[model samples]
Structure formats: structure tokens, C-alpha cells
Target: MNQFNKTINRLGTYCTQWDFVKDRFGKDDVLPFTISDMDISTSPEILLALQKRVDHGIFGYTRWNHPDFKNAIISWYQKRFDCPIQDSWIAYTPSVIYGIVKVLSVYNPQKKPICFITPCYDGFMKILSSNDYPTKTVHQSLDNGVYNLDWNELETALSQSKVFLLCNPNNPNGYVWSVEDLTKIIELCKKHKVIIVSDDIHMDFVYKPALFTPIIKVAQKMDYLDNVVIITSSAKTFNLSSLGGAYIICPNITKLAEYVYLLGNKDSLSSAPALFITSLITGYTQSEAWTDELIEYCHQNLIFVKEYLEKHLPTLSVTIPEGTYFAWVDCSKLGIPMSEIQDKLLNIGKVAIMDGDRYEESAPFLRMIIACPRSKVEDGLKRLVKSLL
Candidate 1:
């Protein structure tokens, strides 16, 4: 009954999430459930807008401060997330990951190690190691399928570490940190002289009844705004990762501006696709109907996954995702080593899922991307369960 079905094509699209891992798994046909992006077709309005821009036939260089581009982003953030912003705080980067790297390079950590909560995104470790920065991880507790932050442990890490890289609505686990929790974390950081690096790229995909609270907002209220640096982008929400439009949100405008100038900023210019996405996101922000529907659909998908697991794979515990479309399934009951389970999934079931050990200390867990269509989710789950059996 959905009108969005016509544009959903698995062919001719060249999705790295699905295509790239096919041969690696030694599968003739891969049922990849690895990456986070949804298999569902993008919003028609977004595609049309991008197409129209392409039809214009002018592919000239564009600036990030273009009136429409800047206004679109500003208007969208204010309307969607209640993140009030000044024009001066917005600085463009090629990607959110790139912005994170800049924070590592610019911030003088001295002797203090950078701390991130463990069972985190695997790439963060790679980033830290690549930069040669020492990292200390605070492991979260596993309670009733939900991952809970050990506040005391977190504080201990923050006290010793200089930079705390926080993932809001945290990745792999999908636990949305409450405002009160964030306030406490900021207070601890303030007490410890810790600089906060908040990655809030998944802020927009939050399901209702659970809100995505920006750490910066809480930091600002606590007069700890100067200690915070936020990196976010519309790429994840708008399905425009290739567009390469992202911003670093920090209140110390003069510091960032001087830093950019010092670095001889070369790639700050936004592209045509970025402009198109900004325009598309502007409309989406103004009209919540699409996002509302999307959230509802995602929540239903989560419910479906939970119910499916309970009935078929009773031993596999899954945390009902508070935000984002990822379901972290605890696979300890199967008695197989994490590597063996991953191998079985790829070779036997033709399924490619993210291994648990990648998140650090989550060895018996399986991260499933539940962002695809319900039919695809069902197929993946069936294949996974069959592989386990």
C-alpha cells in the first residue's frame, strides 16, 4: 500500500552496504544486514529536488555560506530539534568523521587519554589508533538486554581523560542517554576539566516517547558550553552520505574560525548535492509528517524484530531500541564463539552481520541493521535463526 515502493531498487544503485561484502563472505548471493542505512527508497521529494538541480546543468563550485544552503540548515535544525543556532557557529566539513579527526588534531590532549564508552562504533578505535592517541574505554553494564552506563566508572574515566568522545543515542547499542544523565555527565566533565566531543549524527532518527537530547544544549544550560564540541550532519537522515555536507557546532566561533584559517581550510566549500539535500531537509523539517511516518514505521519494524526474536529465537535477547534502527542481539546462549557465529552467518546463511567483538567486550553479541523493509528484515531474521539452529 506504500507509494514509496516504486523507487526501491537493489540493482543499479551500487550500495556499498550490500554490494561490497558479497564476495568477502564467499556467498553467491549475499543477504547483507551489515550497514545502518535503510534499504527503503529515499523520500521522493528529496530525489526530485536533486534531479531538478542536476537538470539545471551547471556543476560549478559552490560555497558553504550560500544564502539558501546556510538558511536551509539553520531553519531545519531550529525547527526539527529545537537546536537554536547563530550563523557564526556553523562551519562546514566534508564529513562528520572528518570533523572528529580535526578535533583530535587541534585539541592539545597533553598527557590525558581520550575516553569513549566501550561497545562503541568500531571505527572510533581505528580513528583513535590512526591518530596515535591513547584511548581508555568505560564499559557499560548489560542489564535485561538494555545497556546501562556505569556512571561512577564513566566519571572515573572522565576524571583521568582529557577528551571524552560521546556518541549520543549511542551506536551499536541504541540507548538514548536521558537529559538528566547528560547533565550529570557534563558536570563530571566540568569537574574533571574534560573536553566533550559529542557525535550526534543520529539525532534526527530518534523514535517518539524517547527524545534525542543534544549534549551541547545541556552543557550550555550548565554554563559548560565552552567545554563542548559537536559534530553532526544531515547525511544519515537524508540518505546523502555521498553528498559530504557536515557542520561542527561550537559556541567559541572565534576559536574555530582562527583554527580553520590556521589550518588553511581547503575543502570547506559545499557541493551541489549538499545544496539540494539542504533544500530537501528544509522541507522535511518544516513538515514533520514524513519524519513522523518514518519514525512510526521504524518503531513498528523494531517491534516486529523483538516479537520475531522472542517467538523463534527465545535465547537471543535483544534490546528494544530507544532510538535508531539497530537491534543489538545478545547471542551468548548459542554457545558458539563470536568468530564462528559470524562465519556461519556469512557462509551458511548468506547473511553478513556486524560482529559483536568489534564493539569491545560485546563478544557474544550480534548487531543487526533493522532499517530495511519489513520483508527484508523477516528474511534476514529467518536466515539468521536458521544459521543458529
Candidate 2:
């Protein structure tokens, strides 16, 4: 078996995905495929680096200004995406959402409403609402099992909003944006004078024939770099979320200063922990092979689910994601209400999956995370089949 197929117990680690599912749903026997984090362990190189840091046993105020740290990030982007990024363009934040909220608050001085492509990462909606920021959603249209951006609706929304939050390799449906698609979005945002803040945390998980194009690259190509910002992290790629380190890449130096000033004022945002820095450096510098293997495993899992559904449940539909480890399955044809389908999955099927409504307008769909051991994926599918069929 590959390293990914090994079932590692995460129950006692205070894991939100496994440990809190029972408390959240009041069910102890539920198998959760809800949270976005992977069940697999992180890279061994990162673990070793972290252990070395622990051995030093000195925890104090740290700075992320080291050349090695910045170079690791720069080298990764250059090697993987063929994009040249300057060290000065990079800044640190606690997480991708933190950087986004900061950008939304500081950059939008006029307080124009923000817009995002719908069926997005649910956290974006929560963060926007919590900040009381007005929002407009551009819903993607599904055709032939793929999700396509509605440029007409998007332009209308962009005209009304000052900032557009883009989720490349879109969540729920996981369609990696094409260069052409991104070029169109850049043109639209540039025309409307809207700032583009792209959350590209899943940039590393893209599958073949579906490339992950950084919005900043598009901005640079169009000489509209000042109008764009990118929020990303190794957290999603290497399971380093709890480490709480993310990078905000701003090509425009003036806007970069604003972000630095705003984050500098917050005492909590002083610097990332040394462990996080170590893990990040190791992840970018030494974990490429591990990430490639993980992506292949996830792709196979996606194929497994699609084939299983086609064979056993012909009436149901599953969207094979171009990126990310999620399988968005449509349950509309099951003849059950969305709420009831969610209930049956939890109560009868004993599996916990995210309802489509959480991402956008309510729909008869469920998003299942397949970034776990093959056995677990098989188990979850069997339970889903038993309950729905």
C-alpha cells in the first residue's frame, strides 16, 4: 500500500474534522467527509525539520525576513508555475482568510460591496458576513459535468463591487481556471476598476489538462499588476493549517506597504512561529515529490468515486473535479429534499458530508472530501450507496 493508504488515527489530536463531528451533529458513529483538511500525514521532511526546531527548544519573537524563507517561496513559484515573484512582493499573515479580510478592510476605503464566484469556499461567505461587508455572488453555470464562469453575470457584479474575491480551482465543483478564463476576468475587473483578491490555496492540487493560473501572472501580463493580490499558503498543500502561516503576494509596492502597515499594527500579527516557518520552508523546498504522489492518490480517489457511482447509482450525478480532493455529488434525483438527504446521510448512512447550500444557494448536492485512505473512501461510498439507493 502507498503511504496515503495508511489510516492514521486523528481522533485524539483535537482535530476539527474527526474529533468534533460527533459533538457538532450529536452522533458518535458518523464518518465525516466534510472538512477540507486531508487525513494523510504531512511530509516527512517537514516533520523532521519541525522536530529539529523543537530540539532547539527556544521559542521567542521571530521574524520572517530571512532570505532562505523568501527564496524558498520564490523558487517554488518559479519552478512549479513558471512565474517570477520578487521577495519584496511577499508578506506574511496568519492564514489566507486573515490576509483577505485585512485586504478587504484596508484596501476598500470607499467600502464598495465585495463580490465572489458562488459555490465558493463557505468560509469566504462567513468572513464577509461577519465583517458586515455587502456581497454580490456570481453563480457558475454547470454544463456537461463542468462548471463554467458566467462572464455576463460576473461583469454585472464586478460593475457593482469594488473588490472581486476569486477562488481559482473553485471549491465544491473544482474547475481549474484556464488562462483564457482568467484573462477575461482580468479584463473585466480592470475595466470596472475593481481590485482582484484571489484565494489560491488550492493551486498545488490541480490535475492534468487543467492548469492553475495565478491571477497575479495574468495581472502582470496585462500590466494591471497593481490591481491584483494573491492569498495562498502551504497549509492546504501540506496539512499545515494549525501552523497558521500564509503568504500574501502583492506586486504593487504601494498596496504592499498598506498591508504591511495594517498587519504591523496588530500585535498578534508580529511574526509567524518558528515551527511554521520551518515547516513552510521544508514543504516548499523538499516536499515536491510527496505532493506529486499525494495529488496522484487524490486523483485516483476521485476516479474511484465516479466509477462507483456510475456502476451502483446510475440516477445520481458526480462532478469529477479538475483539482482539489472533493467530489461534488448531485442528489437531486434521489427524490428527497436537500435537508432530508443531509439528514439521511448523517442519521442513516452514518456519513457526514457538506451540503451544497453551505457553499451557495441551496441545491441537492453534497461535497465529499476524498483525501483519505482508500479504505475510508470505500467505506464512505458504501454507506452513501446503502442509504441513498
Candidate 3:
């Protein structure tokens, strides 16, 4: 009778996580747990809203300037995180990475290496590398599975860096940044005159006892309004990534202008997609309970991963995540080299999990995405253990 137990066939849907497994991992036959997007269904409410929009029959150029779009964003932050942002402060982007790259190009036109914590998102790493931007990382330390930043190292990196990039409730392993953590990061970045670029897309999936604090909320009181910016979307929150809607909240007037200019004039992506805007408003305004259920299901999936690995594959280790649906498993105990782990997994285990080094993590690990049905979670775990054997 569990609502989340329902399975949906995802293959033949051009799903990157399912159909493009061979394109990414060189193995088409394997079950994939590499991409961070969900395998679970989005809110039925959102699907219905999109259908209504489709039925309207006019797919003309859609503008996101309406009050509803901004109000939905404003109310979501206010209700969920107690954050209040001006409607005028919000601007649209095609995706989070699109916003980040625009900010980087405008803010750090010199392309100097930006700084962020280690075991970072592979997407960020790939983007930085693709732009030939040198990056400096201060590897996070662990205190009972919670990722802790080395403050001294962070300060040192910030002192020399132009930007401090963050994926709040960081990916790979889900470490929700406490308010204290956010405060300290803001203080260090402000002290060094560096900008904080945070990707807050995964904020909604945090479990209880661990709150997702947006860096913008923490910096709202500070004098450095121009130094903080966050790019996020309902895409990650509502399984609407394929729909293509993202936005930026910048307190800096000048940089915000530049971002809009880059997006509208330079990139010529002025019009927002109608379906994406509909999805955003509907998901934020109407589908909150759906999000709550999603959090519960994902948290349970992570716990299952931790316990299942401890029981069946003692050599593998996973700590239950505090946020997001990902389980970053430590496979160093298996004595498999980073280079050969995926080969073994694909050929032997018939599983496709991302290698930790792609995120520049120090030790050997595998990042498994578990935002799917319980059956897939169980089957994927069994496959992971088989790969190791």
C-alpha cells in the first residue's frame, strides 16, 4: 500500500540514466545508479497541470514575468526555509549550470581557478574542466560520516579565489550545511572578498533532523549582498529537469544585469518554456505534500542501502545520507583500484555506478543514486555486491 512502491517503465524514454547508460559508462546492459535525477515519479498534480497546459493548444513564446512565477518562488522559500526574497530579485535561466557558467564568465572573466570543497559534484568538475578553469579544492574531513570543512584550509582557499562554488547539502554524500556551517562559509568568503555561488537545486530532499539552509538566507543580513548568488529550480525538486527551467537570485544589481544580458542577448534564450513554468508553479504552490512523501521514501532508501551493504557486503560501506537520495558508498575496503572499479562493476556486477574520482574525492568510492522504487534499490544493491564478488 506504499505510494512510492509503484514502478514505472523508464526505458525508451531517452532517459539519460536509463537509455544513455552505454553513452556514459560504456555498458548499455547494466542497471544504472549514476545520474542524480529521480527514477521515482513526480507529483501526479504536476503531471495533470502540464497536461492542461498542453491541451490549451498554444505553445507560443511564454514569458516568466508574471507575478505567479515569482510569487511561487518567494512563497516556497518563505514557507519552507523562512527565507524572504524580493520578487524583483528573481530572474530566469535555462538550468542551474547555465546560470553558473554565466556568472563565472561575467564574474571571473579572467577564468582564474574557482574554489570549492572536495568530493564535489562531478557536473561542476566537468563544467570547470571544460572551460579550462583551474579549480582548487579543500577536501572535507569526516566526523562520524558528516562531512566537515577544514576551516583554515577553506579560508586560505577563499583568500586567493574569486568564487567559492558550493552544492549545498553537497552531492556524492549528502551533508546538509547547518546554519553555523553556512555562517562560517559566508564569513570566510566575505572576509576574502570572494563571491559565493551555490547551487541549491537539491535543497528540498533533506531528511528531518537535518535542515537544508540556503546560503542566501544566511547572507541576507550581512553587508555583502553582492557577494552571494544561488541558482536553483523545481527541476531537481519535482523531477522536472527535462522540462528545462532554472532561475538565479542575486543581490548584486550589476552582476544580475550582466546575467540577464548574457542569457537574453548573448545566448538568445529569452523565452521560457510554457510547460516548464507551469511545472514550476504547480509543483511549488500545490505539490508540497508530494515533496514530503518523496523525502521520506528517499531517506528510507538510503537507510536500506546502508544496512543492506553492512549485512550482505561487509567490505562495502555506506552512511545514510542526511539530504538528497544519493548513497555515496566507500569501496576502498574492497581493495579495488579507482581505475578498475567501474570495469569490474559493469562486466562482473552488471551495474553502472559513478566513480568517486570523477568528483575528485580523495579515497575510492562509488556514488549510487537511489531515488527510485524500493525494488530497484534492492536489486541495485544485490547487483553491487555481486560486482564486488
TM-score of each: 0.92, 0.97, 0.96
Best-to-worst ranking by TM-score: 2, 3, 1
Of 1 and 3, which scores higher on lDDT?
3
**lDDT (CA) for every model shown?**
0.75, 0.87, 0.86
Residue pairs with colliding backbones in model 2 are: none
Worst 10 residues of 3 by lDDT: 141-150
Clashing pairs in 1: none
Deviation of model 1 at 228, angstroms: 0.9
Window of ten residues with lowest summed lDDT in model 1: 262-271
Error of 2 at 277 (Å): 0.2
Candidate 3 vs. truth: CA RMSD? 1.4
Question: Which structure among the candidates has the greatest lDDT?
Answer: 2
lDDT value for candidate 1? 0.75
List model 2 lDDT by residue over 1-389, tens digit each.
79999999999999989999976567868998978999999999999999989999998988987788899999899888999999999998888998999988777976789999888899998999898889999888565586767789989999999999989888878878889888998899989999999999999989887778888887898988988999999998999888788989998888888888888785458677888899989999999999999999999999999999999987788878888889988777788898778787887889998888888946578889999999999999999988788
lDDT (Cα, tens digit) per residue for candidate 1, span 1-389 = 65422335565567677667665455547688776677765565666776777788876676565555556667767777687766777666666787788766666446358999988887789888888888889888567765677788888888888899998878888878889888888889889998888888887778878888888778879998877888887766666675666777777776667546533445544343445444445545453566667777778878888899899988888878788778888888888798888887877778888887878855598888877778888888998888887
Q: How close is candidate 1 to the true structure, as a TM-score?
A: 0.92
